[model samples]
Target: MGVRWILAAGLWLAGCATSPPPSGLPDSLDVSSRHELTEVPFFPQRDYQCGPASLAMTLAWSGLKVTPEDLKPQVYSAKREGSLPPDMIAAARRRGRIAYPVTSTADLLREVAAGHPVIVLQRLESFWQTQWHYAVVIGYDLERREIVLHSGAEERLAMALDAFEQTWKPWGYWGLVTMDPRRLPASAEPKKYVKAVLGLERTQRWQEAEQAYSSALARWPHHLTAWIGLGNSRYALGNLAGAEQAFRSAVRAKPDSGIPYNNLAHVLMEMNRTEEALAVIRQAIRLGGPQISVYKKTLAEIQRRRNS
Candidate 1:
């Protein structure tokens, strides 16, 4: 199975249009009938390296100077004869990029129109054979009813929209848009965006996580997790004041959530505001949620500090 085999496999399926346009797409997506991210770089895959190649294109477009070769060790799986989707996601996260999944065709187009190239997995052959292939979708012409891709050995492969869906849908319409943490995908939902940022935070990329958290708050003001993550990241970077401000914002966002109060108490204690810390922890303990035990611990720690 190579590029030729993959292309040949899809030829019979290209002309028979089947999948319908997805419903409930945002009005913002209708702003264009034709759109393309021409600046998105292309890397022709070599053998079972389409995953790395496709990821490289999107990562580079996100302003990172990377190559398929550099990504192979991180994303490729010789045992599986290709890269796993989770591995691809982790690779992007490790590089300080958000690997946001664009599962619907409409959202994929939305991201492309917003100048983001998407990495999509396709089952090139019949469902039985399952010739799984990775490709980058960089453009689409809704007027002409075509999808543009930077496929293997073909920098500009144009397939019919329905044809692309036939190949993509079997894979659960699975696609991903790699982007800077500072930027959110055009079709980002608040919960998904915050989850992606949380994944980035696990990578210990505090700076990028901070940018993403800040961006999340900009879009969805006073999102509780976004504020808490922003505070945590700021604290990691030695910006106690900024962290305190973020925690304060979080406290305002969800006054009943003990999580924010517990975090805010910690930040206040770090700033040597022991009295304020005690007050915050007491509120958290009083209005406790899931972390009641953690709040109790925080109160004890604050008391210990005051006594010393």
Candidate 2:
């Protein structure tokens, strides 16, 4: 299979010293978000009907390929705010598929009201754990006024839509999916693994993050994000050799992406490979990496170091 190369975005290190702890770890390790949950709806449901994996599977089965870049929280938020067209929905429905992307519980209710099968993604907190979980809303019972969903392991359950919405809205009422099995992916396993890795990385659990990323690579070796995360963690841990290999793999995977180029240049500079670093940074600039000023500043510094 051809490698898919994507440029890595510049690492945003604001307040790096105070970065929050990783999510999805044991509660003892969690750092408080300080942000209150004001928007998410809380509902009592026996099961959750739809989730990230299910949505990914449904899309794949429908012949739609969703990349990690496409599912960024920002992208979903944009879709919810009506900034993007519902192309996914229109595309699937054209093939006699039934699915919709819903930004709010109101949207899901509208679909339910129309007697159409709906798949919803909702932000949820497990009552028992108080941990955030993304769930899929699969079906609803009008008589009981309960929204049905597919919880991670619960398979399926129902809850009052209003209560569920109230609890979930705070996390972002972003949800979308297809109703037919034909719309599911050939395998939801890859997407599931990818998410698990990201969850670990975001929470800054380096060891677990590394293991999760490694596991993802075992499944999808060419996964660019996995390589990027692996490279990043290695770099953070001062394993320059390992970091270099991971970044190189990322570049090989997505040659078109400037992110790996920029990152590779940074690593090369750390190793005092000035000439090579200059060349790679130039490539990154050519490929549209950001912070041109910083790059120029680095070039000056490199020249100074060489002259000295």
Top TM-score: which candidate number?
Answer: 1
Please give, for residues 238-289, the per-residue lDDT of candidate 2 as tens digits.
7888888988998898887667766677777778888987887677667665
Q: What TM-score does structure 1 among the candidates reach?
A: 0.89
* Reference-based lDDT, each prediction: 0.82, 0.49
User: Which residue runs does candidate 2 get wrong by more than 4 Å?
Assistant: 1-196, 289-301, 304-308
Clashes of 2: 37
Candidate 1 Cα errors over 4 Å, as ranges: 1-29, 126-129
Q: Per-prediction TM-score, please?
A: 0.89, 0.40
Residue 89's lDDT within candidate 1 is 86
List, residue by residue over 173-259, the lDDT tens digit for candidate 1. Answer: 888998898788998999888888888878888899899988988999968888888988888898999989988998899898888
